[model samples]
Target chain A: MADPMKIRATASGDVCEIKVLMSHPMETGQRKESDGKIVPAHFIQTFTIAVNGKTVIDAGTGTSVSRNPVFGFKVKGPKAGDKVTVSWVDNLGDKRTDEATVA
Target chain B: MDATRRTLLRGMGSTGLLAAAIAAGVLKPTRVFAAEYNKVAFEAKDLAGGLKGIGAASPAESKDIVLSAPEIAENGAVVSVTVASKIPGTSALAVFVEKNPMPLSAHFQFLNGALPEARLNVKMSQTSLIKAVALANGKAYMAQKEVKVTMGGCGG
Candidate 1:
């Protein structure tokens, strides 16, 4: 549906963290096709990140954003070796989920 | 066949690409332009289903989350972007394209909320909007903006 996802994380002076990237066009539904048809606004309304099955970051969106977005956040109480799960949904009702561990 | 012609162009070099682009312009602009619609249409199901994995989130403005990108990009083909969230309960964070082929472009979920952040370069076919939704403390909050792509990045 969108694009392949990429994820990265690191230690900020002894603090471990992770980051992620997703592919999307992020249409605002206000544009038109070459033929002059209205393209409806379609974007991921919200997404979540979990570490060790616990919640850490929660966010949402509308049409006032750019496509192929990136999200960054940090979590403490974890070592260098831990897992993080990420997921999202779009305006057209599309969805994607991917996970990676912190290095 | 149209498929053959498209494949031939795909197989060709820059010269072929230019010639094909010219041919496409003369033959059918609407069909060529609508090709990206298939991308957005196709990613719909996967994006919708993926978002449902998490139930809810608690919203908070964490100085931990940092969004980095050019305030204005000369080209949208591969605009670099990065996000970082420094919070304890950040289980997952995701990015979305409001008007791309599929809305849910990518997602990052961790075994624990101990680490949540990411960086990537995404392709924008035209001037469009983008969004990022985060999950924390069982609630959700978000940010959004617009990006202008100078040329056609989505494959014609």
Candidate 2:
């Protein structure tokens, strides 16, 4: 269990800069707890980015990402003031969606 | 002068209690607080300046900002790291893993107007200390964390 993810970015050329820190354990289902039960793997598997409703980038993930994962990315041809929506779905049937205006 | 005398007595009472406690060892030991900022500790040649342009310099950094990676890499490999800073006028962030043959793993320059905080993940070549240096307000600061690799890359 984690708090809401935070995001911020800076544009660079055709890139619409983006940074995201989401709240989750991102457990790899590898380690056993004190009771000797293996923790179930739960992680962000898909991330999609769309600018003003036009898709720009998409990605996949794995257990390798950090706990309470943070992601940095860029979108091609996006400008400041443009609306960018970021959404992700983890294997646990949980989903998150957020929007931020470029600046 | 009665009120003044009472106040003085109370002050003295507290001071004496404090003194007694210290002499009896009830007070916790005082610690010298150290300021920590993300810094690098590997060889990056000119990567430190690039990181400076990105606003990640230690308030203690004295040279090239580094992101340490193993010399030969065990798994090919991916490594862990920590970065601290000691500079001033810093407003952005970047990370470099020096063993990958390309020093740079990620770069972060802040938002239009926002607080300065940068964190990231990188693939490393071998085992080395990951460093981060940040510059803020014309001053530099640095911090580092040691990452020991156990699998899949960075040369076992």
Candidate 3:
């Protein structure tokens, strides 16, 4: 099982700021170990964020991202008490889903 | 019983399960998943090639697209980048780091009137030009900024 993602959603006036921190290795497949073996490419391929079950952002990421990636966003429609869920699928078919209530 | 050995054992355990799944026909390996990773874009040496790899032909320079990043990155391994488009009807946003081994970092698609904004952390091999491209009404607009890296990222 993958580690749980950390998500925060704060509403200010009409916009809600959402921040996420994902725990991942984000290996680019280009790096080699001390034994001179190439590490296979293993990274998050797709990331999605939804508010109240409505999709807001769908992203495609590559190995170039840093380990334990952090993402932020601003949405207009969501208010306090709305459901905000963030999920990601990695290259190895591993999936993680976590959610936070809009504050 | 070191950390490296533990990690290796864990990796081997996952691989063993994957092999077992394949043998049991629980997971049918398909080309769809394999083709999802854009190898060409990641291998592109220049900005034009990277853009071409992602299917953005000629993006016009625009000030409406905001590329928020620090002028100096204290840590290149986790530099915060945020791209927001002020253009109406924006649909997509892509980020590229010109100096990294791979230029194309992340691509985002917005649907159902979602705001054209994305914030993510990227690794920079060194000081590089960070570019943001916004697709609005099928037209592409780009904005870029320079970020100096005090410490090298990307295994440099």
Best by TM-score: 3
lDDT of 3 by residue, B113-143 (tens): 4678988999888999999998888788999
DockQ of each: 0.12, 0.03, 0.43
Candidate 1 error regions (>4 Å) = A1-4, B1-156
Q: Is the docking of candidate 1 incorrect, acceptable, medium or high quality?
A: incorrect
DockQ-derived CAPRI band for the predicted complex in model 2: incorrect
**Model 1: residue B93 alpha-carbon error in angstroms:** 14
Leading candidate by DockQ = 3
**Taking the tens digit of each residue's C-alpha lDDT, what string does model 2 give over B1-156?**
656644543454323353344336553112100111111222133455435543444346455344443444344333434332323444434455433433444433333332234334455544545555555555555545455555533222
Off by over 4 Å in 2: A12-14, B1-156
Q: How many residue pairs clash in all the candidates, one count each?
A: 83, 74, 0
1 or 3: which has the higher lDDT? 3
Point out the worst 10-residue segment of candidate 3 chain A by lDDT: A87-96
Q: In candidate 3, which residue ranges exceed 4 Å CA deviation? A: B1-45
lDDT by residue for model 1 over A6-98, one digit each (tens)? 867565555665567777776656568888888766666556666666666555543434566665556666555667777765544356778
lDDT (tens digit, per residue) of candidate 1 on B38-60: 22223453334334533323244
